[model samples]
Target: MPVAVITGGGAGMGLAVATVLVADGWRVALLDVNSTVGEAAAASLNSNQIKDGSEAQSLFIRTDVTKYDDLRTAFATVADRWGGNIDFVFANAGIAGGTDFYNDSDSEPQQPSLLVEEICLRGVVFTSHLAMHYMRRNKPAPGGVIVSTASAASIYASPELPLYAAAKHGVLGLMRSMSLQLASEGIRVNSILPGAIRTTLHTKTIWDQFPVGDFTPVEEVVSTVLGLVNDPTATGRAMEISAGETFDRKQPDYCNETMQRIMQGKSY
Candidate 1:
């Protein structure tokens, strides 16, 4: 059976993804900071194993992605549990950041919290770096797949949420760079940029503010994720999923001195 490691698997889209993967005959390792929710989610998934008869199981590992050591331990545990091969990784943990730059607050605007940067941007990088180590060893599985949860902010600027946008932009850059760097190793990296999904990430006030039918369902994002996981040719692609439509963002080619030097086989 294929093995998957998903960050932020305790709730929302993470749990939804884990449930689907378990039902589809994949053993999953869920990493979440909230041990209670993580364990409960795993139990819920396992409760259905009798119905699926796939004997699929889930392991919940309490992890704070902002900490590198936590990520290393989670990945190692997954590798050991699954016999040293990880078929897939989903780097999906993130926050919306501190107050938006343009929020309607009476208080003066403050800079984005360092915690937001650490979790949203640095956490994704650390997860991807760890994923490469295991994914490279996943032989006989046509290489391993990595899918990250970016956001629509990755492509378009959000003046209201400047730091959130910046963090997502960082995710895109990491995904694109690693996708090209790891292609030869058969490890494909891609990202999903979903628009306003009705997950725990949104508060009730945020949800109520949205027009009816404006927010994309969590299931829609889950379906897109499944598609990306199964598509062998997908790499370095950022898929934008909105309420009524979905599309891939076009990435530009690099043609700078760095590219020229790399093409000439010059070491950096």
Candidate 2:
């Protein structure tokens, strides 16, 4: 069976992906900060509870992705338990928080919170770094796929959550920068930018505010992720899944022939 590791696997899209993979005979480790949801999710995915002595088809490990030690240990445990080869990694752990930075009403200059970036951007970097290491341990060949959960904010503006938008943009940039290089090592890197989907991240009242076509279905996100994972030729791709449709957002074209030649150092 193929082995996979998923961050934020306790709920939402991560758990959904785990469910699909398990049904298809993939062994998975669910890493999440929430022990209760993580344990329950693992148990539910397994036919028999994976006691320490038994072969674990699905395992849950409490991990705070922002902490390197936590991420490193979680990946190591999965590699050690699953025959030392990791086939896929989903750096899907993220959180949403924003503050009004321009506010002048504060009596004191309060420290701005960067928790969103810490979890979304930094976490993905940490997870993918470890992913490459263990995936290179594959016995016969070194190969794996990595996908990070970016957001619609990655490409467009989210005036409501500027910090979150910036963090997601970093995720997109990180994927694009690494994908081309990792392809040489038999690894594929990609990012999934999802529009609003009703999940545990926020209440229904908040999500409901989106107009009709603005809210996307979680099922679409799942399919987009699996499509990228299975497509051998896909790398350095940004898949935007929203409102039951998929689109590829390629890098913008050069401004002009002269600039293109100058920047690319080659003919247009």
Candidate 3:
């Protein structure tokens, strides 16, 4: 069976993706910070397998993606259990938004919390780093696919959450840079950009503020992710899923001949 690891797979789009992958017979390992939810998700998937008269097809590892040891051990555990190779990885764990930059209530000036960037940006970077290590083991065959969860805020400005925007933007940069290098080694890299999906990411009150027509469905995002996983040539793409449609937001070409030459290293 094909083996996959999905961080943040306990709930939201991550769990949904795991559900689809499990149904399709992929052996999956879910890495999440919540033990209760992660274990339950794995059990639910395993229960489905039992109904199908097959062995359990899912496992959950309690992983704090921000920590190297936690992620490293989790990756190694998955590789050891399923074999030495991993076929796919979804670096999809994220927090809703960063703390308000100007909202501190203490009399003294306080240092800002970077937990938002740590989880959103650094989590993705850490996940992708270990993903490459195990995916490389698959050769004789082409290396596996790596998909990170980037937000639409990755490209657009979000004045209300500037720090969150910055971290997600970093995810976009990482995906593009990794794809340029990894494609030559037969590994595809891509990202999903979802707009206004209702999950635990935000409160119901917050979600209610957006127009119903403006909401993007989680299923739409899942479809885009699976599209990338199944397509051999779909890499370096930041696909935006909004209002039931999918669009590959294209990056611009160099502005002029001189800049193009410099960009492509044809000029100094």
Q: Give the count of colliding residue pairs in each prediction.
A: 0, 0, 0
**lDDT (0 to 1) per candidate:** 0.87, 0.88, 0.90
Error of 2 at 172 (Å): 0.4
User: Candidate 2 on 32-132: residue-level lDDT in tens?
Assistant: 99999999999989864333434449999999999999999998898888789999999999988546655566488776777888999999999999998
For model 3, name the residue pairs that clash: none
- Candidate 2's displacement at residue 32, Å, is 0.5
Candidate 1 on 1-268: residue-level lDDT in tens? 8899999999988899988999888989999999999999998888786345656699999999999999999999988878889988999998883464455657876764567678789989999999999988776654798999999999998876788888899999899888988888899999999998877786788779989788888888899899989998999889999996889997866589898778546897
Highest lDDT, which number?
3
List the lowest-lDDT window of 10 residues for candidate 1.
Answer: 97-106
How well does candidate 2 score on lDDT at residue 197? Answer: 81
What is the lDDT, from 0 to 100, of the residue 190 in candidate 2?
A: 96
Q: Model 3: per-residue lDDT, tens digit, 1-268?
A: 8899999999999999999999888899999999999999999998886335677599999999999999999999998898778999999999875476768575877777889999999999999999988777784576999999999999999888888899999999999879988888888999999988988888888889999999888898889999999999999999988898888987778798898787555746
Best by TM-score: 3
Off by over 4 Å in 2: 48-56, 211-213, 256-268
Predicted structure 3: clash tally: 0
TM-score of each: 0.89, 0.91, 0.93
